[model samples]
Target: MILAVGNIKGGVGKTTLAVNLTIALAQQGRDILLVDGDEQRTATTFTELRTEQLGQAGYTAVSLHGAAIRTQVMQLSPKYSDIVIDSGGRDTGSLRAALTVAETLLIPVQPRSFDIWAVDQVAELVKEAREINEGLRAFVILNGADAQGRDNEESAEALSEIEGLEFLPVSIGRRKAFPNAAATGRAVTEQTPKDSKAVEELAALLSAIQ
Candidate 1:
């Protein structure tokens, strides 16, 4: 499967989710490819850190932008069990190109008004992409959700109203375990002094994807 992690809004944890998903899939023994479609190259940096700290990144990582994202990913798809693309925050060529080839698109949004508003833009993009790629499936996952509030519920409600995107029930809360583990090029599941809740949440999200 080719999955793209993207959203029009920045700071919504797109890279975090993409990187973690890539590493987690690799840990599951799948032949994974991590594509850094964003200009920021955060995913590339994370893979480098993983290579430095663990001597192996566990999966292949590459940087591809613009129309090359679609062409290159299509050519490379046969070599891996799955490809996870970390697209840019805005509606750039890279993001648009990624949508053309990806079978699944995961749009992570924070439980905030701004992030909720950004969904419409993403929906429009997905609508356009679906015209060309009929098999595209877009899902919205709430990230950085508050543990004790109706914000998550409100966000999910708003997402459900969007025609092109499906609202995923899995919510990843504002947990320190995410960044703590990412600092060492690790998934929350592999972090020391384990945060069972974080691991469980991620596992549930992965299960939903499958």
Candidate 2:
């Protein structure tokens, strides 16, 4: 499967999710390709750290931006069991190109008014992409959600109203385990002194998408 983690707005944890998901898929013994489609190349950096710290990056990593993302990913798709792309924060050629080839697109949104308002832009993009890639499936997952509040629920409700996005019930809370693990080029599930809640949340998300 070709999956893309993207959003029209930044700070939604797109790279974090892409990197972790790539590692998680590799951990499952699958041949995975991690594509750093974002101009920032954060995913590429994470793979570098993983290689330095662990002596190997569990998955293959590459940097492809703009329309090249579509062409290159299509060429490389047959060699890997799964591919995960960390697209740019905003609507760019990379994101647009990714949408064209990815079978599933996961859009992470924080439980905030600004993030909620930004969904419309994403929906419009999805609408356009579907015209060319009719098989694309877009899902919205809540990220950096507050531990205690109605914000999560409210955001889910708002997202459900959006036509093109399917609101995923699973939410990844604002947990320190995410960054703490990422610092060492690890996923929450692979981190030392594991945070059970964080692991469980990530697992649930993986399952939900499947």
lDDT of 1: 0.92
Q: Ten-residue segment with the worst summed lDDT in candidate 1?
A: 87-96
Identify the leading candidate in terms of lDDT: 1
lDDT of 2: 0.91
| Each candidate: RMSD | 0.8, 0.8
TM-scores for all candidates? 0.98, 0.98
Candidates in order have lDDT scores of: 0.92, 0.91
| Pairs with backbone N, CA or C atoms under 3 Å apart (clashes), candidate 2 | none
lDDT of 1 by residue, 1-210 (tens): 899999988899999999888888988999999999888899999889989998998999999999999999999999999999999876478999999999999999999998999899999999999999999999999999998989999889998999989999998999999999999988888888999998898889888986
Give the C-alpha miss distance for residue 4 in model 1, angstroms. 0.3
- Error of model 2, residue 175, in angstroms: 0.5
